[model samples]
Target: MFITKVFILIIIASITNINNTSALKLECTYREPDLHWEAFSRDYTCEGTIRLDGDDENIRTVTNTHREQMRNADVRGLMIVQQRDLQKFPKGLERHFHHLIGIDFEDCGLTKISSDDLMPFKELLQINLSGNRLTELPNDLFQFNPKLKKIDLSGNLIMHVGLEIFNNLQHLTMINMHDNACTSDNAYATKKEELKELVWELSVECPPTLDMLSSSLFGSKEFIDNIKRISGEDSDDVRNELLNEIQGLEKIVQELKRRL
Candidate 1:
């Protein structure tokens, strides 16, 4: 009876530990003005993540050391490093900022983004490499963090987004190539053609199992509200105007469909 009781107690302890471990996800918030760090800056014991909105220009000034200070203060969640030209600095320093969902480097002049620059952060959510000068990204770029959501490659000098670039990134949502030189009339026309072909090929190989749209798809709440002044769900006048334009497009589609 004593031995049986001991085994039961051990099982109970194991179950409790499992529950605690599962429940220990972290939570963090962007430090707001006036509210500052005090409101969201506890000992970082809360569970989930931290988000640095892409518009936060202050992130550019934050050094890896200062970010390390934030990490050592017991904050172990998402740290969104927005638009900092990390590659301009020496290598290995980026490995230090590996505490969060991922870093956003959109429009940060990355002519060459490698997987080595990203290998340290094992728990990355996604990394935004959009609007860079990268002609090619490493093949196994997403292999390290397969949970990657968005890889926005819009406005870059990329000739072609490789077919295998996204093979491991099942959770990837938006791969933006809009407004790129690749899409221009002058360059990468064939590669862009190949990119479109690959999208079609991949769609056939695997139907998209996820809805991968980022929150940035729609502008910020303030911008969306401003858009409402000109065009939104609540704006009946704007809706009517859009409906009129769509009505015109609908006529064109009808004619095309009839021709088909």
Candidate 2:
């Protein structure tokens, strides 16, 4: 009878412990930078935007959350940095989080990243930098992360992609850049039509060119599939037709601007 009672107590203790742990992992969101400073990792279950009125030192110290964790970190899945007015990003972010499969920094006010900042994560699968204020992308953005599978840099100010940039990322599957300005003057401002044309251009240009250059470029098929998946084009033939139409419209707009 005593053994039976002890087993029942042990089962109850396990159940109680699990309930407590699940309750502790509460998720929430905040807007102000001050709120994030105080509640950095306290509530890991949160998924709210940290909308900053302006840059603050308090907000910049988010790296401290990971610093303590890096002593014996084993994180997998996503890390999101949403809607924050960040003047600076965490240094050595990629080194410490080696197991990170994805990173999302959507709607954050990011201007530039040092070339060395994201070069260490050879195993990174996806990086989503949508809706930011990035102008010139780093030349060696994909050099270090050779195993990168997907990249989303939509809704930013990026004008003019050098041929060399995409040439390096051979294993890239999905690229979800919907609205991006690729003009030198306003790289951050992308029109709907402009985004369409850019997508078409990248799709047609990236396939044969990438394959011809690198033998290990495996994800070209998936990359093309990704382009079709997002653009809603049935096939390459339809994509080409759409591209021509958008290009024609763009040319007319350019001509009007020239006259003005």
Candidate 3:
């Protein structure tokens, strides 16, 4: 189903002819397998231009109007094509989209996501954010969504990742982050200390599940270069627990490599 959405967006981009600065709009519609366009009228557009930041009053009005129109409706799914460059995740999405099961931000140029605004998407199952420009995620970005199953962050500029972003996500099974800077030595160097802190955190907290240990995220050479940062601690118990965590992580990475 996500692949079908990607194909639709590719077709829309091929047909859409706009100057870079011209404002583009988005609206909600359900598409069948035949790919029907249900509504393209102005009312469904919510009088909003897809943008990250602009006039505060205009932004509020746009989001509020959307909230009013779709209030209390069982909006199971939604897909928005910015059809233009939006430099960040559209604000106020959390206030309006409550029952969303899946969302996509393909090719929309989002640099970062809002940690606070995502609190409403507890039931959200899938999130496809491929082809954005995201650099990092907030530490508690996934705090509200424990049941989330799949996340696709492939084809982004992501470099830094918070330690707690993957914590306690027991249901997450698939995460796609291929072709990002997180695996590169230079980019990992920028956050080497931070990554070490995450590795050290395993002594007290429940280590993230084996599936969440994808190397595309934590596999940079610089990360392994400084992997022994916590070895100097005096407590052998702490060192033993850390060593166990490290072995589990290495095993996960090896499994991932075998699959490739």
Q: Pick the candidate with the highest TM-score.
A: 3
Pairs with backbone N, CA or C atoms under 3 Å apart (clashes), candidate 1: 25-47, 26-47, 26-48, 27-46, 27-47, 27-48, 101-125
* Whole-model lDDT per candidate: 0.46, 0.50, 0.54
Sort the predicted structures by lDDT, highest score first: 3, 2, 1
User: TM-scores of all models?
Assistant: 0.42, 0.46, 0.49
Q: Give the TM-score of candidate 1.
A: 0.42
RMSD of 1: 16.7
Winner on TM-score between 1 and 3 is: 3
CA error at residue 125 for candidate 2, angstroms: 0.8
**Which digits, one per residue and each the tens of the lDDT, describe model 3 over residues 109-218?**
67778556567788767677778888666556778878776666767776655556766566665665666755332212114354344334421232333333454345
Model 2 residue 205 CA deviation in Å = 12
Residues 76-170 of candidate 2 have per-residue lDDT tens digits of 33344665655454444434334555556667778865446666666666677777887655435677777766677778776534334555666
lDDT of 1 by residue, 39-117 (tens): 1233232221222333321222222222234543333333323334433312333333335554555565567765665
With candidate 3 superimposed using the best TM-score fit, by how many Å does residue 111's alpha carbon deviate from the native? 0.7
Error (Å) of candidate 2 at residue 147 is 0.9
RMSD of 2: 17.8
